[model samples]
Target chain A: MKIEAMPAEKAARAGGRPGSEALQRRLAVAFAGALVVVTTLSLTVFETARRALASSRLVAHAHEVLQVMNGVEGTLVTAQSAVRGFVITGDEVYLRDRDSALLSLESGVQRLRDLTADNDSQRRRWQALRDRLDERVALLDRLVVIRQTEGAGRAREFLRSVYPPPPPAKTGRIRAITGEMAREEELQLAGRMREEELASAFAVASGVVLAVLFALMFTLGYLAIRRRVAQTFGLNAALLSRTEEAEAANRELEGFSYSVSHDLRSPLRAIDGFSRMLTEDYGERLDDEGRRRLAVVREGSQRMGRLIDDLLEFSRLGKKPLACSAIDMTALAGEVYRELRTADPEGSPAFDLAPLPKGWGDAAMLRQVLANLLSNALKYVRKDRAPRIEVRGWAEDGRNVYCVKDDGIGFDMAHYDKLFGVFQRLHSAEFPGTGVGLAIVQRIVTRHGGKVWAESKPDEGSSFYFSLPQAAMSGFTDPPAARGGRR
Target chain B: MNRSRNVLLVEDNPYDVELTLRAFEQNNIMNELVVVRDGKEALDYLFGAGAYAGRDLGDAPEVVLLDLKLPKIDGLEVLRRMRADERTRRQPVVVLTSSSEEKDVVSSYNLGANSFVRKPVDFTQFTEAAKQLGLYWLVLNEPPPGG
Candidate 1:
């Protein structure tokens, strides 16, 4: 049983066992046991009924024996009365009645013998009664014949000779036989009563025992089910508490991130401010060497300011909620390129705008990603060559694939994993980036349930691809032209 | 060389005060520059109390260049008091500090400073800033009408 319960214990520990499941198992066992108990009880009741029936039959047989004995006694009394009447009146009618009583008396004696045949002592008493009845009938017959033939005087003389009113010495023996028959009838009644009492007591005791057993089983089943339910409730509560703790910790981390990003900017501003002031106030007082050193300090502070801004933005990305909306990639890309041109009028890069699929995402964030990628392509292109960038999109596998290809200084594919990591740069200081741009892009894409990857070689151009679900493309506009190039 | 037109420079760091004085010398703006190490001295000079009790209130500086971070009564409060008083309310006050915090800048501007300039860290940049400020405020910019 202990080994069998291991899986249930493991399930409970894992919070997989539902209260209802445990209760159902307990109820099933309880019901099965109840069914067995009911079957056993039915069998016991059937046996008890059979015993009771046997006892009832014995009681009924004893009652029939008593009735037969009473009939014999009545016949003997009628015979005695008829003989007296016939002797007194000397009528032939009394004689006929006495003969009919003698016939009934013989039948009663035979029935008494048949009924008492099972009891040896009762059978002997029945035989004695039969002999006495036969003697009485013969005397009555003799008395009747005398009353008919010798008339009333001779019949009286014959009755006195035959009966003599039961002599004193023979009266004891006759009373003893009658008392023995009465004792036998009483014994039969007592035996039948004892058997009935035994049967009834067994039935009552069995019923009480079965009821107590059933109650005990029911209590055990109920307690088992209750315990299992409590255990399941406890496990669920523990899981809920763990989940709450994890959520609280995540909230605290976010708050800490916001605080760090917000506070670190103050000191960085001071660094940048004082460095610029040094060059402005003492440029003439210092020599060329001092002036160049001041420029380096100013440049370092400016770079630090940019780094801090990028770091703050990266941290804020995790805390900020995304506002999703349908955006036209082609139009959005064109807008960003125009803005980039205005920002950097000296270096204009060529762009090939292909018919792009539109999708739902934060427009501002997506624009930032496109700006970063395009600007990087423009900045890192070979100095001898004019920068060429291509923006294209298409529908594939229930998702829209948007790719930004650039014929610029491409990276080795072996370092692809480092591209999306914060501050992980493949290039040297020549590439001016704080390295948080791709990290922010990856975060936004992941938040929208999309994926971003890049395919590139050392000399050849690189294409950055991102896929967005169809649901994200709900209200996007379709561009008329398939592709267009700009310089 | 106008000795009567004094400039009150309220700054905490001695190095920054030395640098400002050097920048002013390089600009050749010959005016008496009064230096107060903390907000208390600046307040003393304005109220004519403590070490400067017997000084004439009418001889107050033409401009007060206040630094926000000080040992006692910060620059904002000092500016507040200078503006509240009729005697010095019209004094041209400029906020000069190393801090470039938005809150500090906004608050200094809100407190009625004539101009706000962040103290440059590089020596050359600081020299350039001081010369430009000296030419603009002390030479070109006109003072308000007074007796």
Candidate 2:
């Protein structure tokens, strides 16, 4: 069953089995094969049965025609004998017999004519026999008249002129005609019997051939099934190994991230912790410049700590299984805005939250998106102008598109390419951030089968738009809870 | 109080040890806080084995402040071995580590840790946490008899 032309691994699992496409092809082949076998068997059985039926009908028709001809010939011979008897003895019984014989002959000839209506070959021979029967009947009537008027001697002379006595065994026209028709019917009967025999034999032969074909088809089907079973086993093994490999890689990634969380954070804690110790313990010994340097060291370490935390969060988002449900976007946005407002109590941003369309996504992830965007808006407030943030959403093209417009210090449009990139900051330390907020926004949006982008102009304003799919999308599977978790 | 309560701090980092000592001092936890640098030594001290052979198993520390990352057999293993043994089965373990990873907290709790606290980066906050931990485990909460 394995094809040598294919590679070893493929050869083991190929040839109309492993994949869905191959399975369909295999089913189609089986269907076509069965169709061909059944169609051929049906045609053979139908043709044989039709021929057998026609041959048997022919045999019955020939038998009926011969039987009718025998009655006609017997009536003619009996009528002549009855007429002779009447002429010889001047008997009334013989004349009555002749009259009855004439009636039977006439009806018999008419039935034969009707029966052979479609026979081009029998029409001429049967017509000659019909004319001869009419002549003999006319002669018989004359004899009867002679027996009534003239006498036995005159009737004898008339009969002798038409037909000789039985001693001579004369080939009379009526007898000759009937003899020829009988011979023709016998010939036809023999030919029809032969035809019936041949049709019966062919029927039996076709049945045997059909059985053999059935056996062959079954064998082929059995072999195909065996091959397919083997191929399935091979494919299952291949799939199992691939799955193990993927699981191993996933476990390794989990290990890497676990170490990143555990190992990377302790050192930063030390950096920030020691710097604070220096400022608190040796504040009097250090001058103003030295204290500022210590504060700088502490801020840098704290910033690094934030960077690590943000990156870890972003990494975890990829592996975190999503719990999706319909969310009240307006309420969620308002809640996030309230949370952000608590951070900046002195300057309250004019938070215009419109009635948003209901969104479908993981509530926690979407909440994160909202928190990041709103916090960014609140963080980048232009001190010269009052902070004004607008939250609005609308349904579009099987998605719910939400926009967070902030009239704050927007960056130049040229650097928008790096706006949602991780650690790709457009501004320097003047604007304090790890440049992971927009990246997180993009990640969450994309995970929900959506898109995120920004429209901005420097010194004017910026609007961040993100779309969440209205329904489940293909190719976006909720990942299973990560395995290989270690403490 | 001249002596508060006996506490065991399982830690590997020297810097973390110094800071923890400073925290205990600032909080005025006037007790002998025994420190074990690794998981093996912590197990040894708890079960009175290896280097802590012939050590008294009855006057056990009130709380074991454990760190997850260590050189010999990590902190989760230490908690597991402690919980599995009859002598130290009911010992109160508080996981105080810099790693705020979810697995560490969950696994520590699953391994029968009393509490899981992520050590804050700021020394002031660390000091406050140490004080609260001491107050709760040593003074406010009652320890098991003969533990």
Candidate 3:
């Protein structure tokens, strides 16, 4: 029983047990244990009560037998005296006394027989006593009859002829039999009383043991509940402090970013502006090498400026809460495509845009994702041929999956792991990029609870995929339903 | 161009001050430009007190190009004080600063700034921004009745 509850206790500790379930199990175990103890106590008390009842019956039986034996003895003595009186005085009143004594003795002997019937030894002794009483009564009757018929002289002569005088041993024989039955009943009563004492002691001991066990279980259960409550209190306090610490750290980080926004850019602006001035103002006096050095410095400063802007934008995503709603994928893609077309007017990429499914996300962030992915497809292309890009979307596995496939200068699959990393570039010089674009894209997609991946080969086309949860497409915020349009 | 109309350039950076002057010169706006190094000097010039105690307040600048980060009093506080006084309240103050944080922009507009523009790191963009500032505030847009 104890081993069975161990797993439940472990589950409670592991936080796998729900609050009510753990409490219910604990209460049930406690109740079951208490029930077992109470039932055992009840059974023990019941057995003690039965034993006490039997002991009481034995006591009553012994008392009744003793009383009946005394009555029989008294009646026998009285009858013997009556018979003797009648023989000596030849009186009719003495005969009446013997008759009344004989009647009482007969009833007493019958009661003794009934009482001693259950005990073999007692019944045998009773039978022997009954036989002796019958013999004595017969002698008494014969003497009385003799006295009434022949007169006092003849009755006395008959008695002397049967025995020279009354034999004392013979007359005391009935008294001895009654005395023996009474002594046996007294012995049985003493034995029954001792057993009653022992049984009473055992019942008291069981009551004490049950009380102690109840106290122990109650104390243990109380301590267990208190300990669980205290542990929960400690855990809550720790969680509160940890949340406060995290908030403080977030505030400090915001301050740092503010400084980065203000202080870091000022110097870079000065460097680029001063270097530009140097190039325009003193280019005539400086040699080719100096102009080139100045050009390199300007390029480095501009590149650093772009890197700082991208880094700040990336960090801003983390600080801002997402504004999620149903997104019109087709409209968003169309807008981004127009902007991309305006951005790169020289490279004419053949764009094939298929119907896109309605998705759920922040519209602005999703636009950024489309912008980055599409522009990436546009940017990484073989200079020899025109860029062929296809944008399509579908719903699968409870997600809206969008794919951007492009016939571009694809990358080696070995370095695919670093594709979404910040500041990681496959082709640094040939492709002019800060490499933070894909990282930002991944961050925005991930914030919307989506995943991004790519399939690319060295010379073949590359396809990039991102999926958003379809559950986010709510009926209330869906633009298509609101507009009542097929698009 | 209105050579007599004054344009105040309140900036702490010497390089930026020089760049702004070059941008204005290239744009061929020969307006009388008054350059102050910090907020205090700019306030003094506008209120005609402390250093410019004898100057006339009637010759207020046509436009004030204010930088936010400064040595003494910052630009937003200057704008707040300017808006408080009737003499400088309606003056065209455009916030030109290195910081483009949303808080700064919102606060600048709230404090009665006419416009807010972040200083571009690329000098060419800065030059174009300066040219537009000169043409729009000094030449195209109509000023308040008193200023």
DockQ of each: 0.05, 0.40, 0.51
Cα lDDT of model 2 by residue, A7-80, tens digit: 56555555544576665677667657767877888887888878878877877888888899889878878888
Q: lDDT per residue, candidate 3, A378-441, as tens digits? A: 8899989999999999999989999999999889989999999999998767788899999999
CAPRI class assigned to model 3: medium
Instruction: Work out the iRMS of candidate 1.
Output: 6.7
Clash pairs (backbone) in predicted model 3: none
Give the candidate number with the greatest lDDT. Answer: 3
Which candidate would rank higher by TM-score, 1 or 3? Answer: 3
lDDT of 2 at A442: 91
Candidate 2 per-residue C-alpha lDDT over B1-147 given as tens digits, one digit per residue, 9 for 90 to 100:
122358999999888888888888888988788999999999999889999999878878889999999988899999999999888888888999977777787899999999999887667678899999989998898776666
Model 1 alpha-carbon miss at residue A114, Å = 52
What DockQ does predicted model 1 obtain?
A: 0.05
Give the distance in Å from residue A276's predicted Cα in candidate 3 to where it truly belongs.
1.5
TM-score of each: 0.46, 0.68, 0.65
Model 2 lDDT at residue A52:
74
Q: lDDT tens string, model 3, B16-95?
A: 88888887887898987789999999899889988999888887788899999887999998999999999899999999
Displacement of residue A77 (Cα, Å) in model 2 is 27
Cand. 2 TM to true fold: 0.68
